[model samples]
Target: MAALACSPADLLPLLGGNATSAAAEYICGRFDAVSSKFVDTGYAVDNTYLLFSTYLVFSMQIGFAMLCAGSVRAKNTMNIMLTNVLDAATGSFFYYLFGFALAFGTPSNGFIGQHFFGLSKFPSQSFDYGFFLFQWAFAIAAAGITSGSIAERTQFGAYLIYSSFLTGLVYPIASHWFWSADGWASPARADNLLFGSGVIDFAGSGVVHMVGGIAGLWGALIEGPRIGRFDHSGKPVTLRGHSATLVVLGTFLLWFGWYGFNPGSFLNILKAYGVSGSYYGQWSAIGRTAVTTTLAGSTAALTTLFGKRVLVGHWNVTDVCNGLLGGFAAITAGCAVVDPWAAILCGFVAAWVLIGFNKLAEKLKYDDPLEAAQLHGGCGAWGLLFTGLFAKQAYVNEVYPGVENRPYGLFMGGGGGLLAAQVVQILVVAAWTSVTMGTLFFILHKMKLLRISHEEEVAGMDLTSHGGLAYEFEAEEKKEISF
Candidate 1:
């Protein structure tokens, strides 16, 4: 395809000593006449931004892979890494084939999307395509969380079945409830508003993170504990990760990726605050979101350090990594809605949320290898309620045009309406996720395909499942055979 070209006359300079004053006036007059008629249209810039952010978010799979790999015994490293890799490989196709349609299909029924399969219904514009690709990345990330929690024990084949169900069916419906334009939870709709206008989950703390968390919860329960995870008395045994360095490194990658996950949720910076091409408004929101995201993570990491020290007399690096993730998950729902101080407060509480939930899950005998339920689920729910408690009305109005009826925070004098909606939002999503994932895992369990044999688990999944070792170099040298 050839690029569009302007006429030589259009290129004629209007400001020069050599040019006549009349010519300059004519050029100026022509530009003014056409400028308003053909508005900037900003499609290329906006779509490109979406593509870039989506690409960045896609990198989070690496973060998840490394974090899970390092958190597990060295024997499961290859298995864990392969699962993360397969998430993107398989999840992309699954979401592309059916998930996108189920999530954002037009003529929505306010429950599930009723349309979408072929391109016959979807627009072929840059924005449409960009939105699909961007959300595809997010959908995969949400599914990836489950892989980590179920690592080391579950059969590789069973993981695939659950993955397909989640990315194709479970995740999309959960996302549609809060993100799709026609969803009952959508603020744009008036009559179905959960509280003031609707439920508010700006960047999917409840949608993405909590969905994963709930699935992780059911997965842990159904799969049961790994070998040696509990004693004869049912006391929990500490099975530490193999590499703190990799865990910390993975944490850094996730933190970096969140710059996209949070700010990029706005979709279009040129038009987010209303009146297309309001650059200042978009830029302001982006900057504020970044500051809040950073503060939340930083404050939570610091808080976790101190809290862990007090709890165990030693600062646990894995806890620190979880703290970082919990903070990121906690602030995601409100990054664009709340002030920096609120983000700090949200993160400060998020660290303890992770700590508290981690202990509680252990106490309750939930064998979550990666603590996904506590970090993603608990902190994600916290993110939504934090927004309802701290988001300002003025910012809400700016973000949502004609937001007179929309909800805002409690401390900002907006009452407890939004907070109530947030509580319901998390509960409803949590229930939905539990039922669906529980059924999926239960079916797999009944079929005798959920986990590997006890012998295989004792021998390590890497050897039995993949037919190889993740740490071949670490193997002891073979002794000479006797005659």
Candidate 2:
């Protein structure tokens, strides 16, 4: 062994000191150099992951646009597409101006962030740029989700305003409370340890999807459903969209996008204080979370397909897509913490949640075009609660280390405390979204800027709002026939 491991440190004695002293100094210097290299390399590797993941998340905007455009009337397709594009653009501007700072800047009594405005707080040599970019993707996603529920009749100018506040103020404040280190809702920052790690939302079921879902409900109410959505007798009319083919295509795109949404939520497992010697980047919860996300969506899709057939005497394509999305929303909060089997359960049950809430929304005379109220709002709540019930203690430990008092599932013998905290989390998130988005829509409604005129609504937004239809092929075909 001695022959095999020659003491390279012994050569340091030629510089000045005795072999023992020089060896010790040389080893210490090398240790420092290696450690510095480790930190720098880790940062680069992790930041690259964040940047790529954020790009994937940004692609979901295209998914949202396609989904909403297919779900609306053909005449309004261009309007939906245009609004979706502008949603990202407008939300990005506002988020860059102040949203990132408000969510992640220096803590201000755990209420709001107070730095990073104009990117000033982003260090020249820090990983913060990737973090901000990833977070901006999330901010825009939340705003874009709201567009689907209130489609067909919403005024373009009003939607832009909605995007600005949702990305800049409302969503950021909620993000601060749940995601920031010093926020009151953080399990890590909670003053009371009894609350089970401060409401463990691995992703942003409550922070992102829930906010958008609630905003959608408010917009539906303030805009008072599309024209002829309900008859004189207040009976609902099923106004089918122009393209089931497009709807199916859009659902698949969203499913692909959610791989980025759920797994990417981990940001990076190479984060500081991660698994020891995990420099090769093999060890991470990302794989498991990705599996859970896939299982949840797949399970919910199959479950809804059969369940809807039994309940309605036939299969509905739209409900199938809603179930798929509901499953994704449900698993999001607990994907990193729950077992694969538990994720299956979450998805299966989330399908029913979507159905129930869709029925509830219809009963209340609220028309949600893409079932946003059910798929996101209802399943977002269920996802949070399901995490409390099914989260594994070991998985929680892996995600959040160094905490002896972390959370575990109720079924795992951790008592009802974690479940209780999850309930409070759901309620608080719902209330916050309701208050903020409701107020925004209400003020917009009072100003008469929220909806288009009745004539404009019937005339079709593509022609009335955008001065053209999305598919000119139909007109061209007709022209050829007439000739």
Candidate 3:
């Protein structure tokens, strides 16, 4: 909340010498009351905006469920959908219990947060319940991304264990490293900025997307690709999804949710850019952020449409959708600081980044059913680099204030300090996620709890573990009476 610009004492000069002391006191009391009301109104409006954004971000989970359901074979649709549901349900429990604390607990060191465990001393001056809800939505999204990479073949128990750990510990720690004011890499840090600029991950391309993607990369690598993803002769075989309709629908839903994911990161829409009465402010910046996000996603979709048409000889909606998401992931880091034109470039390159990663995955026989690692991980890294290269100095100052002559994008004539900080963010996120999620995946694999038996893989986990196939047309047909 903003402080009152004037106090009754500051206004005392306006009173004439003839005014009585009691009359002056009465006027000051009224002024104080009005000032208190203004503060209350600000909190009310900001909280409403935050809660609405939280709902939009939470809706992305439904989109994830639909996308995961369509990407996998029909035999495992139920199993994948169930995991998506649990990603939200189970994620909520753990994230609420401690994830919020670990990510945003203030008065702590640069590494990990140590206070607010179980939301102790709730709703302090710095944060409120709505803020906690908003962060919780982001924490679960990281878990949702990893579920896509290890879909179909991963065991149910393993999913439970990894999802809990990722949401509760792994993902929160990454967020703390970049988003928290006390974070080591946060641009909002008051002192000792990384490389004298700190990371400018405005909306968490590295903190969320890269963390999720790297974790998925390790899981898929450890699981050794889904059975029969490669033929006996080692040629890559295409395992097409069961439905393009769900994929398209899910993509659109996610696109809708991203408006909240990016713009809502501002957390306050009523803030002014300069004076209190000025037309330009955080709201205008929020609109600009939305524009950048849209441009990046749109450009990536078109690029993928043309690029894939040339390579695959036909239009692929699923590929285009993935490309669109890749663009969004890439733009997330610099959405507030880069121009719309720069966002187009970010998206244009992100499409190729994803396509290139997919080709490499095939060459290495790495199988991700939804291309989660490529679209999120590969493009997410590109987004951080994009910020380092293109972030505008004026916009950077406006978004991250309290720093004088701060470093901006290297390409924008601000020097290489910001770029170096971004590079550090990418390395630290990759290394940390690999150490934690990678080790957990490897341990799960050694215990035979990561993948199902060969027979179950062939039959699909939906029937063996989930009790039935997602679609039961044949079973329904058998129930018909003979004439």
Candidate 4:
């Protein structure tokens, strides 16, 4: 047993003492007296931000499942849901195995990732594994976006192959160039030269959404329209989704989740480690991003409702959902930079653009079941341009201190430099994604494995591909009749 004599007055001086304080411990003790300080060392689980991001991204998967299942014929609902499930499960496995390495590798060069596999050579302390898991959710979302566009027609095996390639290679490579530290689109890199801002994709407009849209386009082009989708004279036919209720529900989920998606991309709201702990470095930027994203989504939904009324003379729930998504997609590139008002304006414009592209794809005979091209590609391009037009000097300085901030846009009283950069980024993404995804589709087509037989298409994917039906009720009803 050890005893020490220290009064409350004695401890107070020790805590914040002046040099003149000479209070002696005049205690004759049998045991040694020692003072020790304790540090609360902890490995913080930053799951608040990661969980939000994952939840948003995972919700996108659910939305995708519902959207895909709704768009397909009722008989193929189970098959479509299965496809969405496989996309997350299998795609997540691949992303963890190899795709993450490619997308977020330690930079040997500023081009694509040179690392070969998952977590290769990365020190455990350098990265939180949860970060990788969150990114995996994004990879899964990208792969699933195309599932609806080619629903009920694509072969199951072929779909798997495409999903694997999209998650493991295509999306990873694009994300690396944009989101990774050594990427060409890295904001720190002055060598890009084409843009003063270095292809500012705050979230993943060009990376995730555009990549998914391009892949969907290739798949649709290779597979052709669904059977009975066109007459002998090539007149178009509109095939309705299985359930509008499911579609609306999915849209609401996605809308709620976007609050997490754009803001959580900050990774750390409390302390983001990029450039000397600037005010706009993490928390502030993310706060603004949340505001912008919310504003844009709301404006887009309203604009879509109004646009459909004016154009089609009826209120279409599907278009409204698409409008909201399109606005979200458009703002994704610069969600952290643009003001909330700018975001609302950008979203309002994006609704019209998305609707235009939807109609345009139809005129071109492109059978896109989900309008991914409009929601991602057309509106994503708008996001990039909006950054040029709406990015403020104060926000830029706070976000990236010591970096040369450019003032452009019609409102900011600057010239066309920023706009030029936006155009360049858009064109580069379009060209690269189109060429690569198109080639992959061409290879699949040459193998004659892209689409199932015409008879199988009519039977629906649930039976032809998966050998199952969504509604066992109908089957049971027939059995009762026979009995």
Candidate 4 residue lDDT tens string, 351-464 = 988988878887778787788876887888888888778877666555544556454464665456666777777887788778877888888888987888889888887887
Better of 2 and 3 by TM-score: 3
The digit string of per-residue lDDT tens for model 2 on 47-119 reads 7877777888888888888788878889999999988898899988999998988988864657798888878
For candidate 2, the lDDT comes to 0.83
Best by lDDT: 3
Give a tens-digit lDDT track for model 1, residues 255-274. Answer: 88898899998887655455
* CA-lDDT, candidates in order: 0.84, 0.83, 0.92, 0.76
TM per candidate comes to: 0.90, 0.92, 0.97, 0.86
The best candidate in terms of TM-score: 3
lDDT of 3 by residue, 463-483 (tens): 999888889887778777432
Q: lDDT order of candidates, best first?
A: 3, 1, 2, 4
Give the range where candidate 1 is weakest over 10 consecutive residues by summed lDDT. 474-483
- Give lDDT for model 3: 0.92
Clashing pairs in 1: none
